[model samples]
Target: MQIPEYQLFVHPSDRNELRKNIWQDDPITAKLTIGKKKYAIDLAYRGSHIRDLRKKSYRVTFSKPSMFRGAKEVHWNAEFKDPSLLRNKLSFDFFEEIGCLSPKARFISLKMNGKNEGLYLELESVDEYFLGNRKLPNGAIFYAVDGDANFSLMSDLDNKVKESLLVGYEKKYGSEQDEVHLQELIFMINTLPQEQFETEIVKYINVEQYLRWLAGVVFTQNFDGFVHNYALYRNGETGLFEMIPWDYDATWGRDVDGEIMEEDYLRIQGFNTLTARILAIKTFRTHYKNLLEDILTNKFTVDYLKPKIQELHDLIRPYMQQDPYVKENLNVFDHEPAFICTYIEARGNYIRSQLDVLE
Candidate 1:
């Protein structure tokens, strides 16, 4: 496979500025080249704890909006933690298969100032351009940056009453009116009575979309995704909010640290304030159960997923030997496809066994 080459040219002073604050999204001036085309870009280091790794992740913003593959901004992750380095891409593809709107992903070779940076996973940014690419109606997008986005009235940061209804979400694309809609949705979720919430929640959220997204997270066993590592897209056409998956590197039988996670690590229902209320209603709960059942019978099977896993593994294996991070986990890297297939078999059986609990 001929992976795309992404080369960045940054002044030493700007490079020093980016390393100053790893936690902030501050960017310095830079330029990037991709396939003989160069773009004026603002580059910044990205990720939470992954910043500590030798190989770092990056967020690149083009000076010209939608210039790079119809995206003004993009993320290039070192993927240092994943042995197979396929979890994020695999999860996104799985979400797309399940009829959910998800970011497109690919592997690329990266160079910084003429120095080889090995392999990186390039992710399409989820924003106005993302919806435009899908030809969806104009809408607002928000990122659930932390655990506080669990749709709870109480603040996860303090365990007290939240100061604002929009405490946890960072509005990536929205107007002043869109912000008001988010606040209203959070307020309604927290204040409504049982009967009213079940009957009326549908007006605020697309139940089918939410359920499908929930099923994706549950099946992949992304423990942190229920609260964070996702996005909210409020569709302008339907006036209903929908969920989008994000930062999925920590999925597929592994934790964020790339540790071996338990097959039953998370319950089928998934834990979160919004999910609790939605599953409390039997009709929505049954619909969710059916989605899971359909997925297990078709999408989440060992026979079906094994080929895809192997294909991705094979495509990246030759390149894997070149990545320092992949070299460190070479043994684990080679066995990932088999391990993932095993995980699918076990996870499918476990989910099938727990179908009754959804009732």
Candidate 2:
């Protein structure tokens, strides 16, 4: 695949000032060029690594709700620490293939003021536009911005203020700031009796889709995504909330910081309270096991992913080899694909073995 080119033009003074500022919300005026089209956009530094890197991830928002390739906004990720540079794209591919709602992504060549800023991954922003494109019900969208939003009712109680339950969640949509609906969901998850939990839960959340999303996270070992790095949307039609995976650059045998993680670093439980509660139930446990088995047999196996991984590697290799900002060890660039392939094989086998003895 030929990587698309994106050219950004910003004031030299503003660019220097932004380098000194750590805030991600401070936007500067910029003009972006993609193909033959040009757009006036507000560019801002984004992500926790904003202060740690020269080439930073950015959030680009147009002056209007104009659609660029069917997206109103785009998140340009530097992928500085990832050697493979395919984690986010590959994870999203898996989610989409498994029938989960996820953002679209592509690798692109980025240039700032005619200087090659290196290869960046352009991801579709999960906003009203994304909801409309996926044809999913548009409702309240909340981002799990911090660790406190771990689906634990205890975290909610620790903050007596009614609005505190949403402390770690950033509401991306919906007008009312009130936490009534979110509070009710947490209350039910914590206090509901085991027998009634399953039936009652579905009234407020999509349990099947949630389980599938959880399987994706566990299979890919996205530790950060379990408790955080996700979006929760209350379906307008069914009034039930659903989970959307996000920030997967750290997945597939690596931690968020891009350090290698043990293949079995995540325990089936203790990652999120909701998942633990659901797995504790015999019926839900069986359902989850079945889902995992089907995923491993059909979707998550090495035989299925090897060629896909190779395809991505081949597509991104030329650009990645030329990117000077990549921080991974030189040797890692050559060996990382093999490592990912090995992870798929090991993780699938381990999960299957664990499922057999889970009782």
Q: Predict model 2's lDDT versus the native.
A: 0.81
In model 2, the Cα lDDT at residue 357 comes to 45
Instruction: Give the winner by TM-score.
Output: 1
Model 2 residue 323 distance off true place after TM-score fit, in angstroms: 1.3
Q: Write the per-residue lDDT of candidate 1 for residues 1-359, one digit (tens) a residue.
A: 57888888999888887787778787888888888787898888898899988888998889944378888889998888888899999999999999898999999988889987888999999999999999999999999998789899887778998888888899999999999999999989988999798879989999899999999998899999987999999999999999999999888898988999889988998988889999999999999999999998889998888889998888888778877556777788999998888888888888999999888
- Candidate 2 TM-score to native: 0.94
The sequence of per-residue lDDT tens digits that candidate 2 reaches over residues 1-359 is 69998898988998987877767578898988888888889888888854477678999888743668777788999877677888999999999887688889999999999888888999998888888987877788888888778776555335443445566788888756325788778778878898888778778788888888888888888887866889998888888888889889888888877888887887654367788778777777788888888888999988899999988888877777677686345468778889999988888877877886446
Q: What CA RMSD would you report for each candidate?
A: 1.3, 2.2
Instruction: Show model 2 residue runs off by greater than 4 Å.
Output: 156-163, 327-330
- Candidate 1 residue runs with Cα over 4 Å from true position: 64-66
